[model samples]
Target: MILKIFSNNYIINITKSLPRGVYRILPSEEFKKDDIVVFEIPEETKKYLFDRKYVPSIVTSMMKKVASEKIDDVIEINNNNELIINSKNWGKVYKYDSYGRKLPEIDVKKMKVQKGEIFLLSDYSDRSFDGRYFGVVPISSIKYKVELFFRF
Candidate 1:
């Protein structure tokens, strides 16, 4: 579905089958482990996602549009300082060296997802730039929990 925010509209393709029960909860409600939600992506994360292509190397690649508002499937929530996300498409991850230049983090295998962080994953999991690349998100960023209903 294409949702417009501010002036930009974001297109999120919902493909999951709705479970047996469908309900909505108050914002004060606690989040479950596998809840699918819609949340506001921070400006920093939006910029990070936007500038991903031009970071370390300026490759003239065709850039796809990413939005600050996301409909994500929650993976792990705040427990320590980590959130393990499973976004569909992985992007170029940049980490600063001692010199402060943009460089790829080189170690996706050893990278650890921490607690107290709100990491999000794309349901597609094959073409998303999710929490793994952007690191953990804050718990306060989540907006609502939603359920999908497919009528076929």
Candidate 2:
């Protein structure tokens, strides 16, 4: 994963496969009338697997099994490059692995500031030791965004 921070916002590019079942991989740069950009994983990429044959088939099956779990949110890239996500609600944070034992209370709704560090949120809970547990991250730590190039 790469994150490029501009003057006001940031662009994130992911090189690795998304967290198992992320529906949207790369969002389109174009803007629709609704002022939202849609993202979809290419059908060819969706059906292609690296080495495992059954993996792709299984993933396809799981996709059908959990169709409702897909996310269809609107993302707006501002002039400053800041991504304005207009959707059902604000973002959510899951709990971290370590937090499972300590069980820290994280209030996602109250989280206002963007930390400088890479805070790993839990996949299940929000109250976990993420940036809140450690400290603020420095802007210099950010790198480049991931860019996926397609050849026609």
Candidate 3:
């Protein structure tokens, strides 16, 4: 099924991690904010996911779009589920947990991105396994940047 779902670097996502569509991934020397990139899961998170059975053992990669406004930016979330970067409205995120349970409105997080790290969020749907589950990933982890032309 994966063979039929992809060709070369092209991959079709059945999940709404990035708008629930196909994306063209390719090797790149660099990527900018808002560019979706294919990358490896951070080892710490991967282990936690495996130990907790949050993610299957077969999961090896992840697709996360860079959302940090820039290096050394601070990210904040309000009760309204808004992703505020550097005091400016950048985007929104899911307010509910995956199990349809109500989560704390006032997210106790004011994350500041550092050098060689990025802030990613799955803002398309409330059920994405991202949000509080994922945080500041290292830049060196990225493998390919997705082409924005494929409904990215």
Candidate 4:
């Protein structure tokens, strides 16, 4: 995340953040709109994972896009349980994993992000674990922002 040694190299991203591609990975903490950001798994999310989830081979970090960072941006879970942010539909809320298994629950009907946190979404992959499942994440969790250098 904050490692300079990981820079200046073509990092092939197979995660859900963006279409699988070769990207210029940067060690950064700044939040830029539409930027592909990387963050360590949220501590609040540990409750739902296995006991050894922190092991490097397991799920260490994840990459996702900020669905909406604008102040007072409204996030809503519709009657159908779809996630709509800032009046735009993001998709069905995180109810199932990529494998179709049922999962951790969220009960928010409407919310306005005043500060301290931001919502994230899978850039391309459906069922990608993100804010839709774990809910709004603190801004402090962001560790890096990546840029697409090439796409396959």
How high is each candidate's TM-score?
0.44, 0.24, 0.71, 0.76
- lDDT agreement of model 3 with the native: 0.63
Model 4 lDDT per residue over 1-152, tens place: 12223444545676544777776777776675567776777766754654423233465567788787767677777888778776777777666665566777765554445477777787476566677777777788876677777777
TM-score of 3: 0.71
Q: In angstroms, give how far residue 46 of model 3 lies from its true place.
A: 1.6
Clashes of 2: 9
Q: Please give, for residues 1-152, the per-residue lDDT of candidate 1 as tens digits.
A: 21323233222332231222323322444555456655556666556645654232321111112211233433432334233345333232334433565543323344443444454554333334455455445556665555433222
lDDT of 2 by residue, 1-152 (tens): 22334542433332221222123223343222222111222234335331324233433211111001112323333444222344322123233333253322333234333432222212222332223232222223322222223211
Alpha-carbon shift of residue 52 in model 2 (angstroms) = 29
C-alpha positional error of residue 50 in candidate 2 after TM-score superposition, expressed in Å: 28
Model 1's lDDT to the true fold? 0.40
Q: Model 3, 116: alpha-carbon shift in Å?
A: 1.2
Whole-model lDDT per candidate: 0.40, 0.27, 0.63, 0.67
lDDT tens per residue, model 3, 54-145: 56777767776677736566677766866676676545666555667554343426455677776665555545555345667777888777
lDDT of 1 at 135: 49
